[model samples]
Target: MRLANRVRELRARFRLSQHELAEQIEVSRQTIALIERGDYSPSVVIALKMAQLFKEPVEMIFYLEEEQQ
Candidate 1:
């Protein structure tokens, strides 16, 4: 299984640019981009920061999915 997320969608919903979100979440823009692309998984602290900024639960932002074979 692979981890999936709605970071991009929620970021758009909030009308936040990757740079803006990264500032708010105390991460690099590249980190935000990576997370949005599902190329990187964030640590718990970072996840919680994003959840707080987006006013969402961590579970609502990230979840598990079957990996493509």
Candidate 2:
């Protein structure tokens, strides 16, 4: 399984820069980059907060995708 997120799309939809989004979420810019790149999986609380901030459902923001064999 892979942790996939539409963070870039949500950020763009909110007209928020990476730095600004990171600040709002209380995380580092590199953390945001990691999340965007699927290198990191946020905790459930953080994921819920992000979904709330974007006014979207959690499923819309993050999901688990099957990895290629």
Candidate 3:
């Protein structure tokens, strides 16, 4: 399974920069960039923090994609 997210979209909707979101979540901007690029999967704690900040459900922000078999 692959992890996917709508971090960029949500961040834009909230008028937040990557740095701003990272600060709110206590992560580095690079981490936010990685997450936005789908190059990294956040820990549960971080994911929860982001969901709360965006006022979105965790499933709405992050989800797993089943690989086609």
Candidate 4:
């Protein structure tokens, strides 16, 4: 399974640019870009921070998606 997230969607909903979200979550803009592109899985601390900022549960923001074979 691959990790997937709704960060981009949520970020848009909050009217935040990736840089803005990254600043609030204390990460680099590249890190936010990586996460949104599913190229990186963030640490638990990062996930929790995003959850808090988005006012959503971690599970709601991220999940496992079965990789297509």
Weakest 10 consecutive residues of candidate 3 by summed lDDT? 60-69
* lDDT against the true structure, each candidate: 0.93, 0.91, 0.95, 0.97
What TM-scores do the predictions have? 0.96, 0.91, 0.92, 0.97
In model 1, pairs of residues that clash are none
lDDT of 1 by residue, 1-69 (tens): 988999999999999999999998888999999988899999999999988988999999999999998
What's the C-alpha lDDT at position 59 in model 3?
99
Residue by residue across 1-69, what tens digits does model 3's lDDT show? 999999999999999999999999999999999999999999999999998999999999999888679
| lDDT string, candidate 2, 1-69, tens digits | 888999999999899998999999898999888899888999988798899899999999998899989
State in Å the error of residue 59, model 1.
0.4
Regions more than 4 Å wrong, model 1: none
Stronger candidate by lDDT (2 vs 4): 4
CA shift at 12, candidate 1, in angstroms? Answer: 0.3
- Candidate 1 vs. truth: CA RMSD? 0.6
Taking the tens digit of each residue's C-alpha lDDT, what string does model 4 give over 1-69? 999999999999999999899899899999999999999999999999999999999999999999999
Question: What is the clash tally of candidate 1?
Answer: 0
Steric clashes per prediction: 0, 0, 0, 0
Which lDDT value does model 1 have at 7?
95
Rate residue 31 of model 1 by lDDT. 98
Poorly placed runs, candidate 4 (over 4 Å): none
